[model samples]
Target: MPLARSLRLARLHPPQVLALGFIVIIAIGAFLLNLPIAFHGARDLPFLDALFMSTSATCVTGLSVISPGEDFTLFGQLVILTLVQLGGLGFMTMATLVALVAKRRITFKERLILQEAMNHGSVEGIVRLIRRVLLYSLVIEAVGALLLSVRFLLEMPADQAIYFGLFHSISIFNNAGFDLFGMFPGRPGSLIGYVDDPFVNVVTMVLIFLGGIGFIVIDDLLHFRERRKLTLHSKVVLSVSLFLIVFGGLVILVFEYTNPLTLQKLSFPEKMLSSLFQSVSMRSAGVTTLDVGGMRQATQFFSILMMFIGAAPGSSGGGIKVTTFAILVGAVIAMLRGKEDIVLFKRRLARDRVNKAITFTLFSFFFIILGAMILSVTESYDFLGILFEATSAYATAGLSTGLTPQLTGFGKALLMAMMFVGRLGPVTLAFALTPKHEKELVRYPEGKITIG
Candidate 1:
């Protein structure tokens, strides 16, 4: 009873409650992984590295300094996967589901927390929604695993291929990209080392794409079948995502098709496929068919942009999100229209939603800037690479220009903070932390500022 009271008090102080949950989860993961049996290949690691690994896993970002295969045993890998799953589905979601499994009645407070955790509305049957979320996740993952497993069988023996398929499927769907085929069977530049293998790329891309589009959209499509007319959110996500993928592919194909370092050697069709795959892969899914390190500056910059937009909301992938960008665009259009409002699909826009879009944008940009600035002071890397790292961390996109492992202690910590903030989100953390404003009785006269 004392513990419960203490926890409720902690919840009232929101920042600590959120931070504490993250810390506890990381601590548990590190402790389990720091066990003597955790090492796979007789290489003992520093405790800090284990903690970092745990944070990365829980964040579902693939910016790891160590190879999972050589560094950790099966037990540790399983633990990491569990954390990834828990993190991908918000920790609160997992707790709520577990509570339901135990047949425990949810406190009203728990229901509210669950709603907040998932960015969901105050539905009457929120617990049932959580169950639906879990069941839908399992079904999607299972189908993906089955499809991926089929693609893997011809290349690898039955047992090895099945495990590979399962691991990649979960990782991809979670947008975690923690590949066991690192360096292709632990050799550098290889995951089974055949980067050009047709089957692998296709299956991986499909898994990554499935996981990148937010689950809310999926749920909406499934539940509200008659509303095939589409919400602004769904329309924006679909259209923007498609456009970015295609446009990014065209850019990559044009830029890299002549570069000796990347897709120049491939046949034209292969190059196109690779470009298309890479474009889709960039929107917060980290699977890559081509080596990131050797790309041209132009290609690299464009890749950063895609990563910045990321997958849509309520999906596994993270970024400012497509809908946010769309809303921002719509806000601009509204201003140009001089209609005094932003409307989409002939529907009125909520000011709070627009403000949230802008806040998320500003928050993400400023957060990355702060991170890059810190990395500049602490690390020896040049400007562009550091910015890429910072943006990747903030977006939780996990693409790198190869500086992740070389990061200084401070750089790693900064990236870890970025990942955590990226996952919990800036507005959400701010909302949770800030004291609620009481209604003001008075308003000051408006003052005009200079126009652009």
Candidate 2:
């Protein structure tokens, strides 16, 4: 009753309310994970760091101030990775799917929340679709784990290798990017031990790419099963994802071929594999087998672009999303062509959708900028590096420029705030912050302003 009263008072819009619930739940999980009970050994982490880790995990962003490998025991690491799974799969999404599978009915309110969670259209077939998502996820991750374990078994004992393979398979497949090698000198050395292992790199990269491609796209592909006709959404996502993987991989391959900093010294096969890994990592995968900080400025800049773009909508990876990018590009083309309507694949675009896309893109860009500016003022690090980390956090991309660990207490707080906002998103956070609007009475005639 009290909760109901608060919701009524807050005029809680579904999205904002859902976001609040999510963040609060993640915070609680963070607290629990930091508790001594969740650890295999001593719990020595500061409260802020724990909360930050929790938020990062729950957001499915891999950014961390302390290495998970060194800072926490296996239990603690599992907790963080679990949170990542929850974050990516979405708390409400899992719940709704479970309810449906159990022959329980979802409330109308729950459907609305699920709609936003999956970014699917309306609330139609949501229950069935949610079940499909879960089933598909399990099947794909299982196969990925099987492939990944074979590689890991070659490097470690049976039990340990199997567990490691499972953990990493789930993590990469969720696009979580958290690793058990936090003790690995904060570089790619942890994974470097396996750099020459084709099976390991390939499996990990495949999981990361597939995981980042958004479940919505996955659903469409599964539904169509390579059908001659693909939905516009799936087509755009697949086309962009393919282009990014290939183009980004080729660029990294060419640039790092002999650079010594990245892949020049590696064997031809390893170099090719590393390039592929880095390219797949760009969609906010956060895994790395090469020293990102040692790469040339151009590579770093390109990486930033990839992170900014992030993954596809309704997927684990975070960013403005591939669909959003496609929409923005389509808008630009329409404007250039002097067409009043922005059309894609012969389908008319919706105004509210276009507005939402533009707003999301603008708000995301500004939010990152705001975070970077605040970070620049608060931290003494090189401005560009800090900015890169800030965007990485804001996009939930987790591809830091090696400045994450060195951030001051205040800087951590700033980043914590950014991570929270990034995870919740600007529009949702804005909705939470702003007072609810009442139905308006009068409509005012608008005068068109002269524009460029």
Candidate 3:
């Protein structure tokens, strides 16, 4: 096929366009990172390492084969930050924003791509929603940076503090989990030095929550003040998110309360704070105030579950999404109770939505397991560690248990693939790879199978 024909065919599917856009962005990012000016050390970065970092940053997965703060120069860090921002908003949204600024007319195909990217129900008000999202992100990130910079200025030089504040604010808001704390004196661990600092902890957690919650939810809430009503999706997202944060925090507190390597050394108040941060971070943000590698096995397992569930849909964070998980649980309960509908908030979920949720959850689990199995064979790590790393990458949660840096080349490649899939999602990847099927004129009989 000619290049023009191939491009036209690609434009036929929104998912394919989105996936290809990400691949192109990742490739460009990798090439930029491979440049000598991007690094501070004498040796140039290996191609695989650059590719892995590019994938992680562009996927918003913080898993790094090397310490970014110590290894990458200012230019490199800026490049990573750019990738994070682009990845967080998604390429389609960014492109749309550019088109809006350039006064270019957005085609119907572009609108479809934006709708799919934003997970919107209709093409109507999509451009408006994009504008809202962009404005909202900017305002939130600016405020977060200002607040954090104030606190950071007390400890470091003005310029350094400003940069640190901006970097972290963007990283947390994007749920990217990349950090520059490695360069701080006596504070090598990410956010560990701020464990006891209420200002830092609260601000970081707030940003994480705001970002992890979908843009649709934010828009709903913003409009709710006037409408006095919230959409079912927004209601479910907020309720489930609050429950997960509180419940996950309590679980972490109980599991690691006596673990000397984690929270035992901290005061009661500090422990509570650490627990809350850990719980929130595990869901989507990968920044940690404690040693993830030293946590108890139970705590690690709990974190793995949280990571696998991840943040809400249409958000920067990846995974099956909280709504999907909730729908699955609701569906199971409905089935057991012999109910015809999977209902929540006095509303019944559409059959197609439930099916999509089930499909997403199952596919997510399959990929995580497959990645873990691959790692187990290629590396000598324990099963739990492999599983933890795999789930982290597969969910784009980035909360690693120190297994990422030690992974062999094959293992790294496997994880890079996981991060890419996790970010794009299995469904989107499927849509990108498979051609659309035509509906059959003949109907087939359905066969019932016996099950428990």
Model 1, span 50-102: residue lDDT tens: 88778888877877877776677778878888888887877767777667677
Q: Write the per-residue lDDT of candidate 3 for residues 128-215, one digit (tens) a residue.
A: 9999999999999999999999999998999999999999999899999999877655665678878889999999999999999989
The residue pairs in collision within model 3 are none
Model 2 lDDT per residue over 1-452, tens place: 23323543665677776677677767787788778755544546787888878888888778888778777777788788778878888887766656656677676767777787787877888877888788888888888878877776776688877777777777788777777765545445336566677877878877877788888777777768567578888888888888888999999998778787778778887888889888888768777888778887788878877888888878888888888888888899999999988888788888887999999999888888888888898888877788788878877877777898888888888887877777777777787687776788989998898888
Give per-candidate clash totals: 8, 0, 0
Model 2 TM-score is: 0.91
Better of 1 and 2 by TM-score: 1
Task: For model 2, give the 10-residue run with minimal summed lDDT.
Answer: 1-10
- The candidates, ranked best first by TM-score, are 3, 1, 2
TM-score of each: 0.92, 0.91, 0.97
TM-score pick, better of 2 and 3: 3
User: Candidate 3: TM-score?
Assistant: 0.97
Q: What is the RMSD, in Å, between candidate 3 and the native fold over all Cα?
A: 2.1
